[model samples]
Target: MSVGTTQTRQGLGSRLAALSRIVELGPGRVDPKLLTESGQLLLRAGDRLKLSADHTVVALAGGTGSGKSTLFNSISGLELSPTGVRRPTTARAHACVWGLDGAGPLLDWLQIQWRHRFARASALDKGESRLHGLILLDLPDHDSIRALTDTEADRLIQVADLVVWVLDPQKYADASTHRRYVTELAGHEAVTIFVLNQADRLSPEELAECVADLNDLLRREGVEDPVIVTTSATTGEGVDELKTVLADTVARRRAAVQRLEADLDRLTLRLAKAMPDSGAPVPLSSIDDARRIGLTDALCDAVGVPAVGEAMENVYGVRSVEWVGWPYSRWAAKLRPDPLNSLRLGDLRDEIKGLTGGSVSAQAAEVDTAVRALSDGLTVGMHEAWQNGIRDAARSRSAELPQLLSDELSEVAPRLDRVPGWWRLLLVWQYLLVLLFLAGVAWLGTALAYGVFGAGSLPAGLAVFGEAASLPWVGLMVLSVLGLGLLTAVASRNFVMLGAGNERDRLEREMRRRVGTVASAMVIEPVERELARYNEFYSALRGVRG
Candidate 1:
């Protein structure tokens, strides 16, 4: 599709509006300060567009002594400005609208109170319709005495779809002009024309040399292919060529948008580079397992139930059996509640809460610290593994792999605290209770009945009950108590192993999560941030180019 048709159909004003909304959504996403300045400049320029079905505005701009007004007069075939040998000739901007019905809206949009309209002299020589809606602006020098004049020139330069930058032979290589304006506007260089005006003053050789020099300078300034036209208002050299270029530019409506889109694309590419690659899965390790097991073991200890079953039975073995044999055993069991069987996960959770501190924030901090440590350790381990793998792989390639691995491991290792003493105590208690309860059950049954269901009198039953009640004389009772103690010691050892195993598994999971978080923060987040920064920088660079 033709550029003009696309631009006419898809309003630049609407695009600017959408961009404004996007900027609002993430104020800091694109560097609000830079975006704000850029947006303001772009929107202001967009607002000044003199929309027409068939016309394009081309504006000329430059610093004082750049001969912009002289160029304007040469192109329009009319004396548009009062020119002199003085540095600042035009104080106010002048517009020459050709073959347009009225200049009311156009002039109003440009904020121009003075305008001159012209038509071709004859039908046969009619270039009027071809130049229909064309408004040629002779703006005041951008480096003018009046700040407002310079401001207006800048605004016009931004608004004009095509810009003709008039440069004198001497000032063409001005550092301020090149650095502050030319280099910055790399993105918009396509829509820009760098004309070395006052070319008639230079000798043929000097003119050629000057043009070559300027072209080389522009290339260095990042204008890949800049058009350098030599012109003189005195001789009108290259005037016709300049006119033809302008007319063609006007005909191709897509030029401006295409230039702008290219600039945006360049910025997008830079942004993509700044973004980090999403590869490599976060790894899991054993240290994380240890921390989790330690925490759980600590929790079990705090709940006073590392060996809950044995502890409960040891503490109330006789009572438990009496209650079990009673006619109301079912109700007794429900009311009294065996501590081990009646154990609530909530209670254990609460104990964990207490150990970590009752506050969610506190627990979160503890968990975070523990998890972070584990993650760091895993990262270190992974780095070491990578180093070893690299060395093994590069045995056929290089010798620096081991050193690289060491460096990587050092980078990843996390600072760790010694396991808390309470954790060990908890593990010990957990085992002791389990053994005590198990032994108590065995001892109680043996001590209470020698054989299963033997013929017995009330005296015999009373004797058995009496003996069960006595702690010293009854052999079964003495043995059961001794067994309970022994079981406590034995069970405590097993509970420690079980607690360690459980903690290790939990820690492994926690460590994996921590590793993932670290990877996201260290790798992914930095990339995203860099991408955003580059995008904004590119946008600004492109804006200057234009």
Candidate 2:
């Protein structure tokens, strides 16, 4: 092969590779039937490329009584394909292979019977040298009585590198021929040729008119500048012209590649039509600020964020009372129920499972609605297949969501568990005040008992000036201690209430952050990745189209 030919082959190989990538990524985003057909074409093209680039397969197809077999023999210089006027003369396809050394695999790929295959290359025949490297197939008549023959003809026409439609004067304008083959194969003009066989039956002017009519018909069927050659098998008229066309096609060795390229072009266009109108990718923020906030709030509600924060506040209040409340009333704090344990928030995995699997929580339903809303927002104006694909991506990890959320909350739970050091110091201060109150009670009891059961005056040792003034002073000390203890308890209650409120706010913020992470992993990120895949598939499809 020349450098230009090698380069062309390389370019075709790259396009095929891109097409393969599209097929691999197209399962949910493209039509399944279209993808399946494209995949089959790729495999067929690969097998054809590997088998033979040196030889070209040209098939002659026509209706019954069109002299298709006679034209096949005239071009091959051998009576290889049988010719007869029987209703269904040729039952099977015949191959007159010029270079048969490496054509067995290709003919097998074409599904040609081995008995119908014949060799044309001979050193003694110089005239046959020009046709070397050509595999000429004489297909069964398409309008034959037997349906099987028509099927064989259609199959061979598709597999052949180039097709020569042999049209006699009688069936040149056959409706079935035009509808079934010519119109359908319109885009294959690059690798197609038309031959008006049995031209000896028509006068020179009549033949010209027939050829012009056929050209007009083909052009109407979207075949531009149709190559129609007039020929006669008995007189060998215009046979050389058809031979020259075949020889040149064989020499270029590009018919097979070109045929495959045409197939790719047709398939890619079909696939492209199934794609979404917009090719731009959706970003992560496709879930806009309002949508993000909505999703987060829904997720928070589903995971019981408000419940958890409220529980944290209540727990803080109970714990504060245990540490800083008056020692006499500390037991009452333990009687109040622990808010965290009531909601099963401590066992987050179980809570997550309940939220996701059970239908009782209205908040879980809100979560579902929010997630679906996000998917719908991103998939607007997309093809049905693509919309379904992106929606699937958004929920791809839905089963793992419960566990993921559980993990996140578990991490934040530790932060809420930490106890502040200042609470212990306040507990010490309360104990000191209790001790002072106890001492005052003891001193007053002594003064009261001495004044009631013993002498009328107080004891000198306990007196302030060894006189009755000690009685008033002792009573004053008791009142001061009682007032101070009440004031400290009041201050501690106020401090605990303030701290609990602050802790509730902190817990809420942290829970929102964790819920957001789970939302992103479970819904947002997957949707974004799917959009990215769509863009890749679109770019690869363009490469295949070229």
Per-candidate clashes, comma-separated: 21, 0
- Model 2's alpha-carbon lDDT is 0.77
Q: On a 0 to 100 scale, what is the lDDT of residue 447 in model 2?
A: 59
RMSD of each: 14.8, 5.4
Per-residue CA lDDT of candidate 1, range 1-546, in tens?
A: 466566543654444444454445334334455456546645544544334534566778788888788788777766767788986888777877766565566567778764433333332354545565577778778766784434877666656667788899989988767776687667676688889999989999999999999999999988889988889977899888888777777766555564444444444344334322233333221223454454333322322323332222222332222222222233456566443344344444343323222111113233333333433432332333332322232132113322332233223222211233544564455445446555556545544554333334336644554345533444455455455545544554454455545554554344334434433343334333433433443343333333
Model 2 quality (TM-score): 0.81
List model 2 lDDT by residue over 1-546, tens digit each: 668767877888989999899989888677789889878888888888888888899999998888888888877778878877666678899998887788898889888899988887752355487777898898888887785534888777877899999888988999999999888777888899998988999999999889888889899988887888888988999998888898999988889888888777777777777774575445533555776787788778776777666655655665566776777677654565643343445655344333333212224455666677778887777777778888888778776675666666655653444467887887788788778778767766665666544545545665533333456776787677667766777788788778778876886798788788778778877787787777678778778876
Best by lDDT: 2
Candidate 2, superposed: residue stretches over 4 Å from native: 203-208, 283-298, 318-363, 403-428, 431-455, 459-529
16 in model 2: Cα distance from truth in Å?
1.5
Error of 1 at 462 (Å): 18
Error of 1 at 294 (Å): 16
Global lDDT scores for all candidate models: 0.53, 0.77
